[model samples]
Target: MNNIDGLDSWDGDRDQSVVLSEELRSRLAPPLKIGNFSVHSRVLQAPLSGVTDLVFRRLVRRYAPDSMTYTEMVQASGVHHARSLKKIMDVDPAERPVSIQLFDCRPDFLAEAAEMAVAQEADTIDINMGCPVNKITKNGGGSSLLRDPETAEAIVKTVVDAVHVPVTVKTRIGWDENEITILDFAQRMQDAGAAMITIHARTRSQGYKGAAQWEWIRKVKQQLTIPVIANGDITSIASAVACLEATEADGVMCSRATLGNPFLVGEIDYFLKTGKLKPKPTIAERLICAKEHLQSLYDYKGKRGIYQARKHMTWYAKGFPGSSELRGKLCRVDSVEEGHALIDSALASLA
Candidate 1:
């Protein structure tokens, strides 16, 4: 297999040591069939709230056109009453194989929202049962659903009945360490009409901490016949390969790692398909991408996009000399021009 430019194979990490077998390669090479729908790439871009907007998805799609991308999670109740669609649910006609993720405890509301999502050209309807935010869970949404399997199952069945597209779920292992009930929860979801499931491998309490317990993913994959996509801590091609081998999962999804690096999904997809690594972006190249991200954010969402771009800009300005300093300044950028100038200055200094 070929290695990424400027980085050693496995990035010199011994833990990433493993060989891709012919069997595993064969499984991943075929299009991932979710119920009746098919996705050409096994690597998916997770529906990150406040991050996986149109601008971000465009960047990722440029690199991994065949990969399935998701819209940010939208509130089912919010969509139920609104006459017009929420901006979050908007899908460009060109971005095929996009899933619109919805979060709520009300089966009726979720069913209604799924219809709206389908009307907006969503290829699939994803129930967000894995989000760990306090606001989301307090209202009986997100990871809190792990503790309420009956409600979660009902939501899936209702939405499945409501939409023509396949219904999928994204969830954690359980509410906490002591409550790792994904085995039962996953089986219930599949039985209730979910076409596919993505497991984050962390409990609700872990909240993005600790190592993702991929063992649970293996267990879930074994119990369910539906497509299982392993998520959490998938930061690189090596990690993606490691997770797939360890869990024998049907696919892998990139979450936090794709925050600034939209190229991640495509890179992994290319490796999986051809056994050749995509080159890592240089400091200059990354900064250029960052500048483009800032400009697009401003163009798409105006000043509010600039505020959101702050976090994205900081995510990109890392790993190089003076990057920490650049991050500090970039996060406070008040205008698109300012963001462009700062990234340009950092690129020049790196040269």
Candidate 2:
């Protein structure tokens, strides 16, 4: 395996250095306090469905030890009826600063799920009010909560009362451009006892398209006292610092940017803490990480994990020679050995 440490020289054109302003550095210097829990690093790993399982998070934790990470959003109703949901909520005790993100319209079910999350030793309970999937929204959960602030508030208040650990909310700016209600909605969540709020900065209708309207996050942060984390378009250290400066956000969370590169969170965290840029991983190193990810998923979930690894493998096979061809081959891989062979072949070619 080609470890990141083995790579000393990188293409300077590919890695741009970001200068952190004194004001921004001083502002983010202190620990991010979520209720009573303190996370040393301001950068967080967003809870991505099917992508942020224990196998993936362990890889992320290897790079960003003190940063907070979240479980993929679990359906509160699923937890209420099925024991199988436990697999998604699985948290390693070593991953101390992790949160279990749960989504539902029902306050009781969310509260029950929060309790289960605490038992799993989650550092905090994050309510997913920002997911924009139609299935989630039509079900009266996710970003739909942005439209129904009453239930959203009730969910937060109920869960805060139900759990001993901090309860945070991750939400979008609004349902759509015409209904940008984040200011009022964010206030309601804070009033309802939310310790922190992470703003995705896009309307639910956008569903991740368009430039994230970061200005809305700036507005919400002004009206709230709790730590505000800026999400959406936070891909690189440059973008993270830019967002924090633009929004005056307490932190920035990495979402889609971390798809194939788990090193992103730590890269931003290191830059924020020390005003130094970490070297970007070479393509060969990335392929090696992808190979390890494929094997780890297989070790954890057997054949089903390989099916999931297909997408992840494709995400890794990019930005290099023959990557397009490699991705096409990777997405159809059926076994760990097959995936390893493809990545190994890519690595050998890079060498």
Candidate 3:
């Protein structure tokens, strides 16, 4: 198993659905209330930078209709300075329960961004405090806020005051193993009027590597009065159930696992709502989705979308024979027709 489009780990038996504990099921049955806002589903789609664009969101929404979804993180300064809102901040009116996520260390800029987000019909405003990328952290935003609790608190407080919609924060547990400061950080966010907190259960240093230390989520949940969402490693229903039972957080948010698999959140959501498991998409069905995703990306962003679709196309070309070769070809696709042809051929071969 040579990594093959990076889905080697996901090839495990999909038949074994994790049974939710009676206590966990009972606890999560109600709508998750974030201040005045209420979402019918506990499972949420995490905002992935360079992903979670309007097209991607629409695909996820089709399956997980009631789950909350987020836009990619927007720069608060960008939102404040631009004459018009950036395309990344775009949210469809029909996409209910959508939260617009903004990142920056400047409280005033973040406040201004939140106002713009509300005008765009965001259900809530989410502050991004957990992005570990060098560019974001060096700019005094993202997970760096974890190191500066005061600035993070001010951002939340300011945004909450500026917008009628509920304000929330998504952050990592700490900067590293030595600075595991989430216990205090989460408390400060709640006190600063953040309506909900989503904790990515790894330090900034981990950066999607290593196992997510879920114990930190349990600790944060014990202290927060606001809804606490447990994120990180929530790739499947089994992982979602395990995290909920272990941490007892208000909900789970799906991230990297959803890069090519938009059905994951819906599958987990359906399982939580009903005890039965949703069937995994067959290879042909997945390729069909891949084709649709490619076409939509092209429709939205033109050539740039096709270029960006390359990576996404590769992500979808997995879990079947010849998938590795297909990924190799799809990653170099130069046009919508080229991408579609490659996927169609793959499907034909499988058929």
lDDT of 1 by residue, 17-135 (tens): 44566877897888999999999999999999899999999999999999999999999888777856899888989888799999999999999889989999999999999999999
**Any idea what lDDT model 3 has?**
0.90
- Per-residue lDDT of 314 in model 1: 86
Cα distance off (Å), candidate 2, residue 125: 0.5
Better of 2 and 3 by TM-score: 3
Better TM-score candidate (1, 3): 3
Best-matching candidate per TM-score = 3
Each model's Cα RMSD = 4.0, 4.3, 1.8
Native-vs-model 1 lDDT?
Answer: 0.88
The CA root-mean-square deviation of candidate 3, after full C-alpha superposition on the true structure, stands at 1.8
lDDT of 3 by residue, 1-351 (tens): 121133554642643846767777788899999999999999999998888999999999999999999999999898777857989989988888899999999999999988999999999999999999999999999999999999999898889889999999999999999999999999999999999999999999988888899999999999889999999888788888888889999999998888788888898898898877888888788789999999999999999999888988888888788898998899899999999999988988988
Judge candidate 2 at residue 233 and give its lDDT.
81
* Full candidate order by lDDT, most accurate first: 3, 2, 1
Model 3 TM-score relative to the real fold: 0.97
**TM agreement with the true structure for every prediction:** 0.95, 0.95, 0.97
lDDT of each: 0.88, 0.89, 0.90
